[model samples]
Target: MNRGRQLFGTDGIRGIAGEFPLDPASVYAFGRALGRWLKQQTDQPRVLLGMDTRESSPTLVMQVAAGLRREQARPIFAGVITTPGVAWLTRTMGFDAGVVVSASHNPYRDNGLKVFGPDGFKLPDQAEQELEGAILELRQAEPQPLTQLEPLAPQSSLTDAYLEWLYSHGPQLDGMKIVVDAGHGAASQLAPRLLTELGATVHSIGCEPDGRNINAGYGALFPERAQQEVLQTGAQLGVSFDGDGDRAIFTCSTGRIVDGDAVLWLCARWYLEEGWIANPARVVVGTVMSNFALEKALAERGIRLVRAPVGDKYVLEEMLRHGAILGGEPSGHVIFLRLATTGDGLLTLLQVLRRVAATGDDLATLVRDYRPYPQHLINVRFQNRPQLDNNPAIQSVVEQAERKLAGRGRLVVRVSGTEPVVRIMVEAESEQLAVSTCEEVANAIRSAIESG
Candidate 1:
């Protein structure tokens, strides 16, 4: 057994398929731990399990079901569903917890496990820590044979429930022309069907998931494909969803990509205009990576934009803290807190389409005033992540860059949580300056880290 803190990450336990931590044995153990946790909460606890269209998903699902049955918990399988679908079903079906076996936006070879509470929110940090501790403690004990567990039945049909919820909860997108790119992942099967059923003329690409093709050269991570498809299809707008369909990217009719910052700005404007958001100030939460234009645009409308760290969790936290209703990331992870706890790419897409339909304006025209400033970002790979504030040389370079940009631009530098890389970002009045400044700052960071 591994000692100290387990390998759980900010989202959940994730790794390359058939690799350590994500291997069958470890996944089975994780399932057992998850089941045990729920069993302790209530007798005969139920959990909804969902997965993306990854090749290895079936093996892991079966292992998880076996583990759950070992703990005497009921496991309801919602096969090949999106992450948000699992969360929605968990709350709607009154399950004790929801588990999704997918690595959102990651390559097909990689997989992940994310657990959400009955309220459809990701497990709190402390809850994850406790769960990791429990797994570690259980690992130290003797392992039980798989044959000892009773055979569990797979109960499906949560997808229909999720579809029903989508149609009823939010406004319909009738008579709209929308293009949806499912990234060949979890939403490949459901997103198009739901949108078409909601009365939209849907043009879809990347909807055929053969397991290996999930998120391969498509999806929200790469919106260029969807953008081109939208332009070719002459659709009103386009939505690109990540592997598990928890994040979304958009494209206008002109093949121009509109990221999360722009999407949130548009949504905020629509919400304020329709009085859908109760907050008079029209509070919206965004990450540090959000373009300066978003803040400026919202400020122009008497709306206050709250900046959070570069993660949906932090964005949601800030939203809840300030009683805000909308929040998201620049990477297309838009969260409509009033509708869903976590980011739901499909839900966000539907909401945007509703806005377009209601206003009778093309998506491009609707977002014309929300143009993002030219932003440049450079990643500096390091042997280890160092405290940038503690490094005087790096700090001096940042200050110099900031002073140079002055009121015309912004600078942000931080280490990535999921990778050993330092990100240097700069936004300015011109694209050249943004790129040049980012390079200068990145060079300084590389030099500082190398010197130390």
Candidate 2:
């Protein structure tokens, strides 16, 4: 519930790059604030910096590094790397903090900044609020000339280290035909090569980054492209990663899209059967956006589902608090708390493949039981967002919808953390009911905005 943050959003400060909050001045101030905070924690604290393949990433890194140098903090450069790669390195390499310059699934024209603590997780809200205060104070301060900034070469050894770790730990995909769509982002090189080395027949698309093409008609946002490829090639499976490689969506051999909910079910069943879970019936953490059918299926198996607010960080928090090992979002941000501190597309994909290989089941067959309820979601853009909970008209409309559903459905309405929009979701036993209920709620919100 923390408020009054001017720059930092739920997923970190994101916007069209070279604009407010991402321009040279604001970015440098943010870096300086972060460097000072690290210095406060410990003198000479080291920070690991990584970025995706956006054309502006290199310059942004240089500007941020310049600010870090001012506070005597060491910045280790990891160029063109995935978001989770920075998080993993931060924990393994013992850096005080890690910074990833990526907008994730956002288009190339946009960019963002995400910070991982020494524990390799996103910063807690209190810490982020404190950092935001410092950043705003420094916003008006003088900015160093971009031309005067020196380019920092990537630590080639660190990249090699990450690759080695993946090879040593991840499952071998031998004899499998897998198609990977990197979305022309951070995983452009690593994903295809890693799968090939693991003995999989790898076919790669969207691996070429022209800097401007990241997430262009590919990746999680456009999984249909990967589905088409899977069908055309008759591949055993297909995976598509977001711009920063933190999340992924999969396509089964039958061209069925397997989202995070299905993946969670697959992993939960695997761990339960494998006797890997310490507690079999405690809870599996997921967002409110998770399909209601997932909850029902798990309940039939004596498993409980705990719904956290949207965001992988919130899911991770609930996992830690509840001591649950499995949790993720439907958007393919799966978190294996035992393996990683954040959502990792590559790790999740490999784990799914490993489970398939071990269970001797096709991906589609394995997830056949996860027949999701007919859910409809709509996003309505607004110029100024008002608190829906405080609006009597919106609340009344929602209450009416709830009574109509009468325990046969669910409704979720909230503001987008990253964009200026309100999201409405409805899930029911029938698509007609779901779509009609969802539209009613959306229209109410739209009317509220218009009236305001």
Which stretches of candidate 1 lie above 4 Å from their native place? 1-6, 142-156, 169-176, 280-282, 447-452
lDDT, candidate 2, 1-452, per-residue tens: 33577788878889888998899888888888999999888988899999999998888888889888877888899888899999999999999999999999988989999999998999999999998888878886665445588789899788778877777766776679999999999999989888888889988999999989999999988899899999999999999999999898999999999889988888988877766566745688999999998998888877799999888888998998888998999999999988889999998988988888787888999999789988999998899867898999999999999998888999999888888889999999999999999999999999999899
| RMSD versus native structure for model 2 | 1.6
Worst 10 residues of 2 by lDDT: 139-148
TM-score of 2: 0.96
* Among all candidates shown, the one with the greatest lDDT: 2
Q: How far does residue 127 in candidate 1 sit from its true spot (Å)? A: 0.7
TM-score of 1: 0.92
Please, what are the lDDT tens digits per residue for candidate 1 over residues 113-156?
A: 89999988988887777777776566556254344333334455
Question: lDDT (0-100) at residue 44 of candidate 2?
Answer: 89
Report the Cα RMSD per candidate.
3.1, 1.6
Model 1, residue pairs in steric clash: none
C-alpha lDDT of all candidate models, in order? 0.84, 0.89
